[model samples]
Structure formats: C-alpha cells, structure tokens
Target: MPRQRKRACQDTPEPETEAPAGKLVKANKAEIPAEPLGEAKTSDSPEKNRATKESGNETSRYWLMKSEPESRLEKGIDVKFGIEDLKAQPRQTACWDGVRNYQARNFLRTMKLGEKAFFYHSNCKEPGIAGLVKIVKEAYPDHTQFEKDSPHYDPSSKKDNPKWSMENLILS
Candidate 1:
C-alpha cells in the first residue's frame, strides 16, 4: 500500500478579499480619516442646509410611528394605545429614543404639536398602518440620552446639548 502525503495548512494560499461585482468594499484606516477631538465636521452643504431648514419650516409634516401589537396591546382587538393604557399611564407621553440615524433624528426634530402621524406596525405578519396619532408637544430632549445605564445613552451626547429628542404623542 502507498503511504499518503501530509498537507500543510500554511502552504495553502488564503482566499482573496475581493468583493462581488457592484458591491462596495469596506473602507480601511487609510481611506477613512480619524476625527480629532472637537474637530468633527458636518458634510451638509449650504444648499442642503437651506433645504433642510425650509422643509422643517413647512407645516403639515407627516410621520410614521412603529409599535408592536403584542408588546403594547391592551386587548387583542384594541388597535390604539393611549395615555389611559396601564403601561402608559405613569407618563402621559413616552420618550421616543434610541434613534441613532441622523436623518431619522432630524425627522423627529421636525415634529410639531398637533402634527398628525400614522401608526404603523413593522416586522409583523401583517405590517401596515394601524392607527393615527397626534403630536401633543414639540421636540424636547430625550432623558434617555443622559442615563449611562440606559441602552440608548450616547457618551458623545452632552446633557446640555443632547443630540436625541422626542415629542409627546397621543392617540387620535
């Protein structure tokens, strides 16, 4: 019988790191520059800033609120949850927090009192518009931003200059 030769793992070449066609490659340290303390800059151009301000000033802003039916439902048939709900009774309004996306944060900042928002259920079997809600108050600092124990807390966010904000909402 012929003896089998042993293969060395180190002798085999490693696979190339090329991405599939049309896919973007991840940026490395050389491609992405590190920000210095207090030197962070925004990429918003003058035109873009003007457009954002204009859009924010426009009345009748629309929004969508997502809630899990199983998590917030009182009765199986109850479609709307309000301040009267046991879980929501302590605070007439709940702080809408944990939004890390800057664009979504900007949207939250644009909410005004009496503004209408459609309540939608995402990641559900039947995801669609569930009900309607009204903005009871304008944007205010989300307290969760300051609590280090909270999952939403951001060390980069200062209490005096909180980056996360939310508004009081009520079922309509």
Candidate 2:
C-alpha cells in the first residue's frame, strides 16, 4: 500500500488514495491503457537519463508531475485527475493546471516547449511514474483559477494580472 498524502490545489487540500487494481478509466467511461503496475524502471546512463532538447543556446529540462489517480473532492469539485484523464483529452492534450504554490507556479512558468516530464501517480496504492508527457505549450494564465466552482479557483486573482499559471501538455 502507498502512503496517503495531501494534494495542494492552490489553497485547497485533497486527500490522495490508492488506485484500484484494474484498467485506467476516463471521465467519459472509456478505458485507456494504463502503465504496468510494479516498480518503475530506471536507467543510470547520463545520456538516457538526460532527456533534453536543445533549442538555440538553451536546453529543455525534465520534470516530474504528480497527480491523483482516484477521485477526491475539494471545494465541491472533484480534483481527481491523473495520467489517464490526460490521455483522454483531445489529441492527448490538456492544461496542467490547479497548481497554486508560488514556487511551483514559478517552475511552471519556466517550462519550455518540447520539454518532457514524467507523469507520476501520486497518493495512490501503487504510486510511481505512470508515463511521460511533453510540454506542448508554455506557461499561460490558468483558467481554473477564474472559475468560482473550481477547487483551484482564487477569488483574489485578477484577469488583468493572474496570480496562477499553467502549461499545456500532450502525452508522449
């Protein structure tokens, strides 16, 4: 069993739970492929470990993003979103939103297009890296922060000067 943890959606906290043993489920009741359940494989080679893309003089960096696999409610909104949910999006693309931490938001702002990230399944029974996603778009204003019903919403955030940011990712 994996230890439970609190996920931060801005100031809201959602309890994480273990994912049930079965297929990955989408919001539309469709079944999507899930990562194999077991220990995650790793490589020690610097070449393989460093998944970077060179652009001009800058190199894209790697990142690990954690999401809950099971359903969890926060502020009347279900904050349960994971790799499977992402894979179900149109063209396998979705906004990496709901992050409110200032530091984490800053990190999101720094992400470059074409960068790859490990989609880690957090707060689940078999928590581990589920798959990889590519940064298809750079940081932008997170629309979830503007929705009053969203768990990530912030009443104080202004449209002219958004306090939160998000990135667009596609399954890789």
Candidate 3:
C-alpha cells in the first residue's frame, strides 16, 4: 500500500466520474460544486462538460507545490517529503503522493505527464520557491488512506473506490 492522506471533505460534492487511465483532464470549469453537502449542484453554463483526456502530443504544464519547511526539511519531526530528502531518494526521486485535500487530489488526477512544478517552501523561516520537480508518474489510487495507524488514514475509503490518489515526483 502507498502512503496515507486526509480524505476529502464530506461536504464536497463528488466528481461526475473518474478520469480514464493514461489520459489528461483539464479543469476548465470556473468553479466546482463543493461547499456543504446539502446545497444543490450549480453550474455557470447551461451545458455540462466532462473531463477529457488528451489523445496526442500535448504541451507541458506548470504548477506550484507548497510545503512548510519544518514539515519536510531534513530532521524535521513530520519528515514529509522535503527538499533535501527528495535529493537523497533513489535517482533523486520520490513519490509526490499522500495529499489529503479533495481539490488537490483532483488537480493531480488531471495532471499531464512530464509536467513541471515549482516546489515552494511555505510557512518557514525563509519561505520561497525552493526548487523544481517533474511529474514522473501519473496519478493512481493512494493506498495509505486505509492504513488505520497512518495519520492520513480514512476508514470510510475503500480499495475498489479509492478516495485518494498519488503521483511520483523526480527532482529536476
């Protein structure tokens, strides 16, 4: 199993469907219907659209991954994937997985292969863009959500219908 992560908010409305395997999805919607669970689903446009995957050569995209320096920096108690730790990984790569937020999970699901993101260190003594990381692997079910002992564990999540996903990142 993979690392655990916090599950999505129960109030957040679910996506219409999961993105297909080996495909790309663009979150073109102005906003997604997520607030409280009781509210009715709303859309800015009359027509409905689905997340589409790219079939051919696609352009690379950019992203910014923020983290608190103390959480991931070397010798930190939390020891989540930090800048220096990623450098020591085999091939200087590590799994960019274990995110618990629903919205963040959606972004990872729709991400394209080879996309590059700026690793920004947040809430630290010196907070700024630390380095770069490339998406080496596509999103897949994060198995950690089910681990009872893990901080990210979610008993409500199931294997067949995983509530979380993850990807592998290589330092660039």
In terms of TM-score, the best-performing candidate is 2
Clashing pairs for model 1 are: none
Which runs of model 1 end up more than 4 angstroms from their true locations?
Answer: 1-58, 68-93
1-172: candidate 3 lDDT, tens digit per residue: 2342222222122223432222112223233232211212233453422222254334445676655546442222253545765565545555655578988888888765667676766555665566777767778877667766656667889998999987776667
- Preferred candidate (lDDT higher): 2 or 3: 2
TM-score of 1: 0.52
Candidate 2 similarity to native, TM-score: 0.68
Off by over 4 Å in 2: 1-56
Clashes within 3 Å, all models in order: 0, 1, 2
Give model 1's clash tally. Answer: 0
Per-residue lDDT value at 142 in model 2: 85
> What is the full ranking by TM-score, best candidate first?
2, 3, 1
lDDT by residue for model 2 over 48-129, one digit each (tens)? 4433334334455667676888977776556777876766555566677889888778778877777767677877776766
Residues 1-172 of candidate 1 have per-residue lDDT tens digits of: 2221111111122222321222112222222111111211233664433222234553354576654443322122223332223133322234454566776677778776666665555544555555555666667777666766554568899977889876665555
TM-score of each: 0.52, 0.68, 0.62
Residue 102 alpha-carbon offset, candidate 3, angstroms:
1.0
To one decimal, what is the Cα RMSD in angstroms of model 3 from the true structure? 12.6
Looking at model 3, report the run of 10 residues with the lowest lDDT sum.
32-41
Candidate 2 global CA lDDT score? 0.65
